[model samples]
Target: RGFFTSNRDGGQGYDDIYKFLETKRLLCEQELYGEITDLETSALLPDAKVSLFDSRFNLVSVTNSDEKGNYSFNVECGKTYNVRAEKIEYTTKEQKVTVDDKRGKTHLPIALEKSTCKVAIGDDLGKCFGIKMIYFDLDKYDIRREAAFDLEKILDVLSQNPTMKLDIRSHTDSRQTFKYNEILSEKRAKSTINWLIKNGVDPSRLTGRGYGETQLVNQCADGVKCSEEEHQLNRRSEFIITGL
Candidate 1:
């Protein structure tokens, strides 16, 4: 009898070859199509580092900026990546880039801003005390653009002194009932607290209290007619340094 290779054995070999060919085809397609562009300004920047990360922020690749402050990297299509740029004396910038199937190349430009001067915790707590309080409109607790700068400064102070504790106090004008004002004030205080927490402030170091119309900074008593500005002064949010 002649020796014969079984059909099963022949079929296994064919399947292995097919898989190998498919993998090679995929590699060739990726090499031909994947592309990316790095955009930067013609400014003298220090050693800037650029990195790409997956959706989970896992570092996929790292590259340094060219002399002209430019960096680039190739990424596969149909993937989402977070691009982060960093330098020593500059604020870190991050952007999200998504490569679409139709668009093979993406241009991502990042501009870095100068970092702000760091303030120490013990620098002068009284510097903020002079600012007095933040007043809100009736039944509203949103921090207006006018107060954003002060809040940013407060955040800076908190960042400088990581161990500092603050009491976020909320007050209201006497025009509203005590019970209603109390609830509104509390909501306002909590809203401000939430903003701070969202901006990276430690929640454990912050506590909130609502004084309603109980603590009046001005002489506008309950029965007295007061101007809008005077009433505003009474309806305020304040932060006090409880612990250092």
Candidate 2:
């Protein structure tokens, strides 16, 4: 017989013990349980996606690690399976297991490595490295101190990847004539490229161009009434990965 404590609708304040008759039981199917962690820090990685694949590399099942970084899966004995764990900003990790009828359960552990680059090649962004849309003071082409600090991130990424090339584009708000803004944006683009060259980056690895106010992010285009913050969104610099 089995027994448990419960508080039913008509029961008293104190919990009462309920009993049940024992019934014939069957053994459960074999299962796999595992944990995922960081390779360097050994910290548990929660919410990581875990996928199970058969010996033929065909996906069998998928699940995510719990908040405690634990995951489980049921399996057929004598079948070989591969498990892959993945999370953003981290390299994916895989492990293989072969289940046996003799074992009722299997334990697997995975350690994922951290990726070097947060933004990959061909990533276009309005902000990065705690800096929002690299912008210059009014009528200025030279790089600002804050912008220089933000550009350092690009330098680091380029230094890490010697073969990578970057394309720089500069834009301006639509406060001035089209030709005026185009010329100012072109100067700003040249200034950015020169700064990179002065910082020891190969000039051959970069190409700078200007689109002026032609590609406004919002309705702050010519004669549009918008706040300074809204206009500021259109006045910015953009970096695009041109080549590997």
Candidate 3:
């Protein structure tokens, strides 16, 4: 549908809005909007940080939910975006949305589950986000970027509790000799402790050691053939609050 002005050379010499039907391209401004709420109660959540990321996980834009739990964004049509909503002590929720070519606004409501990180003395920050293992490349003990993010949860807890003491234990699968595994475990454990000390935690409150391959969460130890995932169950870092 399209329109043309008649005031230029017609009998009705006045500006007027006209309506017509035709096949033509028209520009459209696309928008995305929705509400953030609690998953358990369906209650509206306010002040939640809402972020949009592209397919590569690169951040595109960020916004916050208002007091009414409403958030919106100007978006492009025919593109997929990952919308994530997060708040402190709440489990972050992410959903992938593909905005179709159809015009107007798209509604994407998300609900966040409550986090299990209780900040108690026996809590394992590593397991708080449902990610139990902090993986290390074989023979590498340095903290990776993904590992750093996981460690931040522990750092946050320790920072809030000055008297908390952590026992950092690093373990490795039984792919190598016992002595070698023990040494590697110790190195990895110490590396974990060093990360905490380097960040802000006190040296006196942290103690670490490697358990070698002594503790296997599954039957993937020694020479038993197992999938890579089963082997990964044995390679993990355990951060426990031993004292508070």
Please name the candidate that would achieve the greatest TM-score relative to the true structure.
3
lDDT of 3 by residue, 108-225 (tens): 9999888765656677755655534677767778887657655655665566567889898899989989999999999999998899899988899999899999998889878799
lDDT of 1 by residue, 48-72 (tens): 7777776665667888877666677
- TM-score of candidate 2 to 2 decimals: 0.51
Return the candidate ranking by TM-score, descending: 3, 2, 1
Candidate 2 per-residue lDDT over residues 101-187, each given as its tens digit: 654888899998887645556766224223245788777788886577456556655775688788889999899899999999999
How high is each candidate's TM-score? 0.49, 0.51, 0.64
Ten-residue stretch with the least lDDT total in model 3: 124-133
> What lDDT score goes with residue 119 in model 2?
59
Task: Report clash pairs, candidate 3.
Answer: none
TM-score of candidate 3 relative to the true fold: 0.64
Off by over 4 Å in 2: 1-113, 116-121, 125-132
Off by over 4 Å in 3: 1-34, 50-63, 70-84, 92-108, 115-120, 127-131, 155-164, 196-205
Residue pairs with backbone overlap in model 2: none
- With candidate 3 superimposed using the best TM-score fit, by how many Å does residue 239's alpha carbon deviate from the native? 1.9
Candidate ordering by lDDT (highest first): 3, 2, 1
Between 2 and 3, whose TM-score is larger?
3
